[model samples]
Target chain A: MKIEHPYLMFLGDAPDELAAKTAIGIKQWRPEWCVAQLSLPGCQADLGLPEMSIAEAKAAGVKTIVLGVANRGGIIGPAWMETLLAAIDAGMDIANGLHTRLSTIPELVQAANAKGVKLFDVRHFDGKLPVGNGEKRPGKRVLAVGTDCSVGKMYTALALDAEMKKRGMKSTFRATGQTGIFIAGEGISVDAVISDFISGAVETIAPANEPDHWDVVEGQGSLFHASFAGVSMGLIHGSQPDAIIVCHEPTRTHMRGLPGYKLPDLKTTMDVNLMHARLTNPDCVVAGFAINTKSLDDAAAKKLLAEVEAEFGLPCVDPVRTGVASIVDKLQEI
Target chain B: MKIEHPYLMFLGDAPDELAAKTAIGIKQWRPEWCVAQLSLPGCQADLGLPEMSIAEAKAAGVKTIVLGVANRGGIIGPAWMETLLAAIDAGMDIANGLHTRLSTIPELVQAANAKGVKLFDVRHFDGKLPVGNGEKRPGKRVLAVGTDCSVGKMYTALALDAEMKKRGMKSTFRATGQTGIFIAGEGISVDAVISDFISGAVETIAPANEPDHWDVVEGQGSLFHASFAGVSMGLIHGSQPDAIIVCHEPTRTHMRGLPGYKLPDLKTTMDVNLMHARLTNPDCVVAGFAINTKSLDDAAAKKLLAEVEAEFGLPCVDPVRTGVASIVDKLQEI
Candidate 1:
């Protein structure tokens, strides 16, 4: 059966305050989206109110349900599995977006498969706004800000924005993953303000704690965020963007040089998460970018871009070229 | 400081009754090995007792210790981790073998790394065995059997045995793992017969219940029996065998298609077990075989082997090739 008015959910371990804030953030993204904020219980007996949410979803004709399957503060086991099964049996489509744990996947998959339920792996959706017509112009611009974030990612995002804008395309700056949260009071206010200011040419400040939150933001833009967590998978799964940009660490510079660096561990995680996502939602575009130039040396920048393109099979541009002219050029072509 | 004559200990979740028998099995292979078997609680309490024993080694020393890592009929968790750390700190070397729960690898790796101790990821080591050495006329034919009570793993052991015998090489099989307990016997008469038969081939029959009962029967192989409840990692660390072979049901056949079949969930319990094996012994081989080959065909099999080789940069062969003459040709060259 096709699900109608489906609500995407993310299950994970966050502080109680963070959980409440995340719930608020999710609500802001989709005002009409039915969200159940369940506080992870320390024991089976403590699983008091969440049980009712499962029952309510079934009774209220909710077809789709997303769950963050991580227990950050406590241990979840067979009893938790039983609770999840009840939700599925009650006809809630189950999806998982997790980073810290991997064992949970098999059990969740086995449960979903057993009940003939759809399991969406929300790691393949890339959050990119489509470019319409043959015109290239400056699109909307967004500046994502975070403290102690990866500088390479910021540059790549800006470059993409400039390229799109040069074609007369409009784009927005998305503050996603840790950076998004950092700007939104997860850290010092001074640091956040400074970051926001440095992120020049930002049109709209779309701050997102998780990648899936990008779905709600309107406009064509780039996501510039530090992603040590499973942010890449979440953004890819939730957004289904035209392209993706990743900032590579300096020590591990060459994309394909290291054994596990080129694709990174994220690729394996994506393979599993996206396979599930594709099974549920088939239309998705996959692309990637890597930031390499530390200085404005044009040759070095181009080399880095070329390497990124070769490794991820995506179009990459030098970060130095990210300016109004580049944006206009991109907009004219788009 | 580098440890001399270091003890490599393995702790697992074998039933209390089968601990001694498992210890015996281990001792047989390393006659100069010292063997010690201890109950899960006793081991955890740091009761200053040797876990298992083998004959005295003139060169280094023969000391084998096995302890139960999990409680009787209980799921593994943080307590298990604490217990394991204490044991390792108390001078135990490795924990579970390759078949261990995937939830424990990070902790095990951390503990080993912290103490400068060695870890064995059993599954990978056992799975990747070199079928034929590069010498002409092939190397010695060896059949390793893990006899515990888990029927799920019988097919894997049998397949390895069959493959080894098929190569026109003389091979002998012994009971290891859960099946070893049956040979040691608690209530079953089949244990005696199985024990007697295996005694001829195996140097030590690891009785699950008695760790110190190293009974030396004339002409009968040594019996080293001990519990391996969560000690799959231990097997991977210590025994850098030619290859590793595992038996599982059709449900597990999907593992064959994984990036690294032996280390599919390396971050998890299963992968941790396999990783320990791979890391402890870099030159060892790792492979896996399921009893249900119905899901496997020529194309699927070749793809599976290719996946293993690509992930680990190692050679993998099908157990079905035990009868193929080309196997002999490859072995002869090895």
Candidate 2:
């Protein structure tokens, strides 16, 4: 569902900045939509926006209160209920990306229903989607695949979208995860969809567009990660991309959360991604590479990027350090 | 949840044999557990069993009534509700594999709860399951993967399990779909699971067992099918199969339901299945091939099977016509 814009960023008793990373991401990518911040007592995170109460947010024309910050267990804390109710009473929709569904809370559901405002659970998708048909949709798509999950795929996609816009290119950042959903106003969390409908949901998310337009679809889960490769495979096939950007994190020795599992090398990752992607788009090509060099020094990061680019004969960059200009340029050639 | 046996198969006014195929499957595989058949007025299908009413079934010690037939939209007909209530009133649990959940019918739910009998919605799974860890568990696993959906993966798995048992081997058929669940009496519909947990649900379905024990896990969808490769990938990873049997219906030219897409060749299918399967079990091997030669004459099926065996250097047979004797023999070597 489309979450309304001009939002109030909610950081409800967040313990640290990391807890509010999703809110920060929204501000980073869609600053105009982040009108103001709302926080409860003892909240430690801040978006550097002028804090507002429900009345002030409503008066300021905030249409939705986005519960982007997550605390322990990703639950809606008891301390946040009054604030949520007040926002609902003020005729503001609530969009949440937490483990607990807002619909599961009777009080919140009743308040939102009574006020005729919507509750957007960004992590949950409850719409009827057709099964993917692998039809040749009219559009250029570039999916950011990865060597592992949480390896800068989202950031790379956002950067590419931003750079393309700066160049007056028709491009849209397609979100497939919670943080990405907050960054973009609307997108499905593909991983939360039923297994049978993963590809279908992705197909719905990006759909067909102008022949020259590019849907830079954000990826999820590594093909090598045992926990989530299924989601990755579905995303690859449904995207039917003309090109894919391979994302990687250099310093990770093991797969995230599975100590016994090692991440596949960049070459293996790209090769596997291409193999599955070609099922839907037989001409899918490797557009570029996105590396997360946060753990490396500048020299090391530069050395690694250069080596990878030379070896693969593709543009490579850290979306954060290098701004993905080269990758966006490479996308033009594809 | 374990669906109790000694079931009274309900074919509620099924229009034809195909409409009652799932009930037929249950009777074919678990005949001893099928006490009798119960048909409504206008039912055209028969399982060649004595027809019984709810009172007769209860008197004969039938513990469950399995609604194993489907109408046009897979919905439960209002006409069947009376019979279902009657069964529940007689202390019989209900197990259904339909689009309509038994728990959603307040009347049946109320009756079942009052009678202290359970209602099983086999197509739905509502339990806690951990994410697949891809750990090396002790067991010999053989997974039956297919070229597309409904290409006899379940039949092949069941055949393999039956053959293994006939030869005094420790084997079990693990179901992954509704028909298979009816045959096996218990299973989680992997495709129905959330995308993130497809593999995890499978892992739970076939947990650790004796080193010599075999979990003949039935497969779903295909890696080449755009609509459902996600489910296939998850099944492959979660099986951690020591060996995989490739099932194919040679007559089909296109991937199921997607007329624009052609099925991958057997070699390509095997290679891709192995590539994905290797993530969980590095030592995974192709055990054999199970072909659906239903459309071919006996001689043609035999010749085709021989040719495929020669091409792949693996044992190949039609599970229905020739049985899986050679495949079971091949499994012994692995």
Candidate 3:
């Protein structure tokens, strides 16, 4: 739950659409954890955070330079090597949440070790998780689902957990992917797991052992997103949540990482998720909706929220702009 | 397409339910490819084929020993090593479709090489597949989807392809898993693939490039099976199928590998699958139903088929016993 020290996030060679992941993630949850944003030319204008140069970030006592945006294909380019080595020599640790491991790269590994700073590759996990056997969990499972990847599944779960703990409820935000793993410090990178063992990994992480506690689990990939659908299904089954919070990014026309694939509607999306969830636990229900209207203006977002609420008869709110109180209320009742 | 030589199958200490996979798979399609069945003491009676000792298989000119059943968790037991090594020493090539590859085991590798016999790890592959883009395939795609794993997705696709070719249609049976890979000689093991690239693998296998033809694509997992629903979704989205053959095992009470998970009914399964498929291809439709009525007696099987046809208003048949002509006819019309 602690950042330990201030961190500067470097969005080196990250495209605008992809680079927003780090800026958006920090804005919604831990704005304080990030002191500034460092981006190159084209992406600098739309980073959605206070802009700062490397010198300014260092002057602000930033301990780690987080590689925030998970680039497509998770590649760390040879062009970025000079900047990375310079940061390490400047006595700052680096945290990466890419599929490629920083530990495996000899040049980066030696540079970080020389400065006595850590290189956290959040996506890298050595432990193998077995397939989930639907073991009896000790607590209520509240899993946050979404219409597509990076639509706020983890943020919704985290936001819901933060809100619940504010009322003195014991809640656990179970991380299922790399960024969530970075935020939580420990988790099975569910996508990194072998196909057969995904559910098992989720079950192990949120084993329902904590009595009266709510395990707010993160979701990955959408039921609609063709790329990571297997990971999504595994998370749903393994977590075995009694209540589901459907997160939707309203402005997303297509699934992330999968262009030309149109997103499913809110109702279809909710029904599809619940239809599968009910397969393992028949009593499973869609408790509420966590909408991400970040792309819409405040007034237009409110209008769209009202429309969705009227259509689905569920409490809907952008968890980032407004707290997830409405969804939390529905969840507690469930 | 060429067997080249005959092969014996080894199902070592595999549980009765799982061992049936090998017995049933070979019995339906490539009975001629298999010379004899080789099992340890316990699984012998339930093999559903003519039994053979190692000596009998070799004398009968069996060219390879195929590991038929894919074990749960894909774990190859240490206890089975003696039997496998003996088979290698006896000059029998070993073919495995399990995720636990024989190529990774030193003992098996050394023994096979010494005997000059090839070891076929069907699930093992070096090439990485990308995410399936809903490309304009040249030929029509008819995917065989199912309500649960082992409900005969692969069997139905194979059966439909056979029937179509018999009727003088250009049909290609594209295998998505290991057993089908062994039978077909080449195909991607979709479940073994990374979660992100499942659809891409399917696209590569069943690309719509064959004009005036049918790609009878094999489906994996189930939309209702809590454990592998993601794989199911990926297959559906990646294939961008023009039509769907919904397969079901009439007498099964639960999904394979997921204990106590009651199978989703045919109509609901069809609706849920189509709902996701339409996210990419709006013209996608459930063409027919492939009922695996193997466990039922003749009268009961016929009665169940009649009931399914009446209920769903689709062509229903046990693709193996009765052939997939009814389903194939429905596909051609679509």
Candidate 4:
């Protein structure tokens, strides 16, 4: 779904900073599109943007109100209804990444219909998608795969895209998840799609582009995670990337939510990902590594990165501290 | 959904035998369950069963009227409503495998509610499924993986289950597709599930069982297929099969629905499937091979099977022509 900007970031009584993760991510990645912040009474989080009402946001030419907070139970509680309706009346579209569908709220639906504003629920994908044909499409693509879930894959992708752009290369960030979608302003939440269309949805998200252009596609679940490897496989085959940056978090003892399942080693993870990826793009290669060294001291993180680089003969970096310039440089060979 | 036995197969105005493919498959695999057949005036297909009205079928102890025909469009047409409603009134539940949802028919819904009957739409999966946790569970599960889509995966699964039972082994057939669901009387159409829950739904389909018991799980799609590798990946990881029987059609030149993409070699397909399967079941192995030889002459089919058997040092048989006896024999090691 394409959510138009500039957006009014809605932090509707969010309980804490983590609740406003999506909004914070949007502001961090696409600062130009986040025109203002709209908060309800008792809201505990902020994006540090100019506080604005519906009228003020409209005056600033806000095109959409982004429901970017994760409230308890992910519901649109009664407390947030009045402000949401006011924004709808102000002629701005609504983009939500919540369990509660915006279309489920009758008053918002009615007002949005009257105002001709669109409602985008990024978590639900009902649009028709073709089965993936496995055809090679024109474009150079790179995907950020991971050793496990929540291991900085999205941050690596965005960093790669930014670095590529800074190098004056023709590149675009292709988002495949919620926060990524808000940052990119468009994408398919591949995991929410019907299983049969996972690859097809990814194909649409990163369709054919100019041969010289790079679609730095954001990846999803780990190929080693039992709960979601299917989505990961489809993403790999669908994007058909020429290069993949392996993302990992070394501090985790096991896979997320799976106590006994240890995260696969980076070598196995990369091999498995590349094996499936070769189905669509035979020449797919591992460009580099993105280690989420958040828990590590700078010296320790650098030492680990250097060891991994030495072992694999590829560039390795923490997308946060070291930057992905070397990784983007490696992409030059493609 | 577990559909009751003693089924009245409904071939409502089937234009051709292909339209009644589900009915034909159920009759072939679960002959005892096919008590009778019901047809409309314009029906052109026959299952060679006793013709019975809804009342007659109910009197003969039929518990479910299976809407086993596909109409021009996958819709509950006006023509079939009267018969469907009558069946509900006759105290038989409706189990539909069509794209049309049986719950959408207002009259049928109203009648079924009053009669305390249920509607089973096999194609739609709205039930809640937990995310797969990648834990190894009890039971010996053998999945029938394939070289491409539309190979003999389901047939081989059924054959293995049947032969295992004949040998006094505790075995059950786990269905993963529409026809397999109808034959087994229960299963999740894995492809129809949400992408994130593919593996989770599969774990439900083939849950932990007796240590010596075998769940001969029906596989779907191919790990090598572009359109549906996601489903295949999930099925492999979720079933955690101790042994996998690779099913392949000997005469196919390319992957299904993709003209340019050639099917992976049998060795590659088996290795890939086993590699993924080993995530949960570390000792997973390729138990046998099931070759679909319907397109080949008897001599050629036999020769091809022998060649594959020698090449891989595995039991190889055509489920239709030579039977899957050898494959079941190999499962004894597991």
Candidate 5:
């Protein structure tokens, strides 16, 4: 089950020039592994030469071939499957980045098993590379938020982390959840809504770079696990805050209708939810942004804000208006 | 580019078993092509001999291998990919089935292209082997629906189809969208809420089994694009019936907070959405069902029914009470 000599071969929509770039990313991430991208002839889309390419890979001493297939209609089509089989015949172990239900293909699985070819499904990783030291313990103070799969929650987290750095605040982005948490530096006022959600009572506090002592918040509910919820509750109980700021996609409705919950129009519901959190934590301030508001007009946007103010009875602001530049300023003033 | 003596390999979860089954399914679907499942040595999950199996597969004159990888987190994971690569190294053509975002796997894509592996993504085949006569027609209709994917829409369609059959009605499940019109049959109904949302039409009739025809309905409002809204509308319009039966998860809420649309409590909202559809189609009798009600007591069930009747002003029945068999019987009588 262990590969003694493994070489990488790229397939399906694999850019010729980008092969080096990929090798770089992999090397950067896993420096211990001797990884190099193997090129094969007849690999171009126009040539459609599956068998010839596979032969080239085998000749190049490539023990492992990574194949890419297209994603269409929420699944992969048939063309890619034909090519993958050709490579297997050419004597190369296969790894695929095809967006199709591979479970449906039985013959391929059996063939690989018989050959002792190790297959790796790449979709689960979803741009997630392994991080942190292998020996490190799992960190605490984790937060998980529910979000639309496409929303750039990760990007927002990165921006927030940058803002924290500019303000001389020590914070770390917790990568376990859909988005990371930014721990604040000293003398930073925690938003009431955030404080309440965390159950932390703090007059003024800052985020920590390490997970050992930091406030963790996430945007998507799907990523929220019971253990994470318990950890959040523990953090909140341990440190009460003056305010809490929640970054979420307002329009996305929670699925399957949990008890005592109503599906909300993505925009208004987000505002109301944030406001409700603020109401529960009177000493906290709540802020939210409509992640999908690019197409929204001024009038529609104003109405959404008004509804939030009316429902939650709290002062609210958009993340865009405050901007990443002013995060330190706002934290300092608070 | 032609694969002269192409060896196709299937790889994934239970690679050996899946490959065997798929070879059978494919052969049955397309008898014109000679296909066989190949087994490799040491690929079995049973922890048996590895070298002997590989030798046997090669001896069988198996030219290709297909891999069936396991599905994880709504997509394929890494183990399957690794296995497929191993088979390619052992001299086999690879075909893979792994679904979920593969755009990020450049190395894998390159290897497959370079190795001339015929990769196939099978998620869109709807569990049916694709057997076509090499003919392409414009606007060909393909209908795909699942019971779980559309919140029991498939079951609802099946129930309605059964009802129609029982009535001795002559109806064909139209494959395409542009088929000639026919009178809506018994137990067919329109989904008013979905219709209103998509086409601005208060009601749109739908037939059984043709869940893909929702695009024809005009005048639906913004809610048409809500998750499963298209399927809902298609079910309504495709039926094109004199009467409509609405089946849905009882907890779901449709478009919330439109002007003059008071936000109903979760229970009330579900009921009202159904009722609204009934109101939109005055000529249709709306029968509704709440799926997955095995846990409720008689009293609780009655209360739910009462609430629906009170809110929607329609006679609604539980599918459980009118057992599936009984309903089929009634449809036969009609």
Candidate 6:
């Protein structure tokens, strides 16, 4: 059955627009699925969408509650339990993509059971994958990598893929995260994969060889994010893309959740990503930028894009506010 | 209970001395634990030790069988299952570190259960780990990294640690692989860690805070191996070592399981490792090389080591034959 409606749940405030990546992605990719967003009064980030209460969501026939924001710990905080329990009592299933599973919480489990509501932990998918043989896969493809974690890599890739499909192109959006898995209906939650199979997981999901085909593989973690940079390198090598779109949120000053560790500049991130990606495909190139200008106004974003494009010699666009036409056109041109 | 006695089992042929890593490590690290080795006549790679058959092994009163020598696919092949079943029937417990578990094999499981023998699968340990914050951990330490999979990385670290201890310095051997887990009684099994926590897993075990301590972090996978480079990168950053010992097998032409990919030379491997390690610790340096000259004769080995030392301007030694004294001494001098 088609997911005609969904209720996104963000129980607290995000530090910035970048941290609101989940809601931003849904609003851009599948706006119709979001029937309502549950946020407390005087709290929440703007994704250019309206908000709705739990009762309003039930009245509107919302089927699932999407935990749409990633917290620092990726666990359901105590402050939000009351709201989550109410959602379960309203007979709605909860779909979470955090590291901590809702099933592990006995109170949530009991409440969900009493109401006959199911719980879906989207990040629990794991399986061994064969070693990636680093050969150049046939056809034109690109991946969207980022300067930091949750910086709009998936949204950029999906937007570019959606645009290509609209023009009747043979394009595929390959997901590597739980949110992407939920959206694509099927994909490996790559973080759950064994270390030896991390690259192989990407290679399998985003395999190329079809004539005139393109695969926009999703990137996970960040090359500079000390906690999980291993996954970043795996995806970079596994995708073996002919081109790459570097994604970033302009206003973030430091690495997410990791204090004292500063974010590398755009140039450093691109250079590092290309060096690692070329560890597999020597022909890989930085094609463009999927700039998340959510933190900046239209005027500031335009100014920043001009400077970045001039310095990096690549086309830059916001997948949400500005369409990803430049990036799509650039990849096709290559 | 201490593992005072173990029966080493290498069911089939190993490609080279480098492939007999488990036996080499055991002979050096815990010789008392190895009661005997099980190998067919006219077979078995040289570990500078004698081989024993199953009948002789039983006559010697062996208690537990240690799965030595990693195979091509990490699965118990058809030819080996019969021998493994026979060992179980003879009232000996089994301990396996292969990717495929003995519990999954119905025939072996039933036989072990009937004979009241226990099975230990060492690669199944996994859990969620916090991300590495990339903070400056206290004290000085070094990690042993390699250019390819199973190229004597773990053995190098253990040898270095042992030598350091013999010199009366404070040092610890931290294992990151299944073989090391078996030897150390406990470890994170770095390959089994979730992608998001790869670095964190390394940090948790190899943490350093003492003013005069060192952590000899065992390496896994390789920087150039496309299959699991992510894990390598994560371990590099998570451990945040002051120095790194690069391990390599002169005979490994391609990656262990991934063919068509030529091995990166020492300089290239060191350059790549330093580039990634510098992402976390800019002060990190490539200390030396733990060369695996298992295929060469004694005279040929000395010549190759001298040439390698002259070229890279770093101390070079085989952990098993040369005993890692040069690497340990060089680290102390640093």
**CAPRI quality of model 2:** high
Better candidate number, 1 or 6, judged by lDDT: 6
Quote the chain B TM-score of every prediction: 0.31, 0.98, 0.80, 0.98, 0.36, 0.74
lDDT of 1 by residue, B1-334 (tens): 0112233334444444344333433333333333343334433332233653222221234221233233454445564566556655554454232235433567767766777765432221221111111111112221221212232333334444444556654433333333232222111111212111211112222112232111211111100111111122112222323344332233342222222122123113223233323332333333433223345776776676566446644343444432223323333332
Task: Output the better candidate (1/5) by lDDT.
Answer: 5
lDDT over C-alpha atoms for residue A186 of model 2: 92
Q: Could you give me the TM-score of model 4 versus the true structure?
A: 0.96
After superposition, the stretches of candidate 2 with alpha carbons farther than 4 Å from their true spots are: none
Model 3, runs deviating above 4 Å: A1-95, A106-120, A124-126, A257-259, B1-24, B31-65, B69-94, B106-119, B124-126, B257-259
Candidate 5's C-alpha runs over 4 A off are A1-155, A164-171, A174-286, A290-322, A325-334, B1-157, B167-287, B291-304, B323-334
What lDDT score goes with residue A208 in model 4?
93
DockQ of 3: 0.43
Residues A1-334 of candidate 5 have per-residue lDDT tens digits of 1222343434344334342333333233233332334333433332122233556656756666554323334343355566566656666666544435344478677767767665544332222111101111122222222222324334444455556656666544433221121111011111112111122211112232353333333332221211111222222222222223334445545322222223334344343333323222323333333233444576775576567556655433334533444333343343
Comparing 1 and 3 by DockQ, which wins? 3
Q: Tens-digit lDDT track for model 6 on A1-334? A: 1122465555355556666676666666777777777765445567665577777788888888877677777767766787788888888888776768888999999999889887777787544578777777776668888889988898888888899999899988887887786576457878887777888888888876686898889888888888878988899989987888899987787889887777788898898888877877788899888888888888998898888889988888888888889878788777
Q: After superposition, how far is residue A202 of candidate 6 from its true place, in Å?
A: 0.9
Please give the TM-score of chain B in predicted model 4: 0.98
Considering summed lDDT, which 10 consecutive residues are worst modelled in model 1 chain B?
B216-225
Candidate with maximal TM-score: 2
Docking class of 6: medium
Q: Where is model 2 chain A poorest over a 10-residue stretch in terms of lDDT?
A: A69-78
* Model 2 residue B212 lDDT score: 96
Q: Candidate 4 — which pairs collide?
A: none
Writing each residue's lDDT as its tens digit, candidate 3 over B1-334 gives 2223576767766766655575467655877777777777556324455678777888899877778775657777766787788788888877786768788998889888888877877675546677666655678888888888888788888888889889999888888888787677568777766666777778888875767788888998887776777677778888888899889987777677656677888888888888777766788988889888889899998998888889989899887778878887888886
Recovered native contacts, candidate 5: 0.00
Better of 3 and 5 by TM-score: 3
Per-residue lDDT of model 2, residues A218-245, tens digit only? 9999899999999999999999999999
Judging by TM-score, tell me the better candidate of 2 and 6: 2
Candidate ordering by TM-score (highest first): 2, 4, 3, 6, 5, 1
What is each candidate's fraction of native interface contacts (fnat)? 0.00, 0.88, 0.55, 0.89, 0.00, 0.91
Off by over 4 Å in 6: A1-24, A33-120, A297-299, B1-24, B35-95, B100-120, B297-300, B320-323
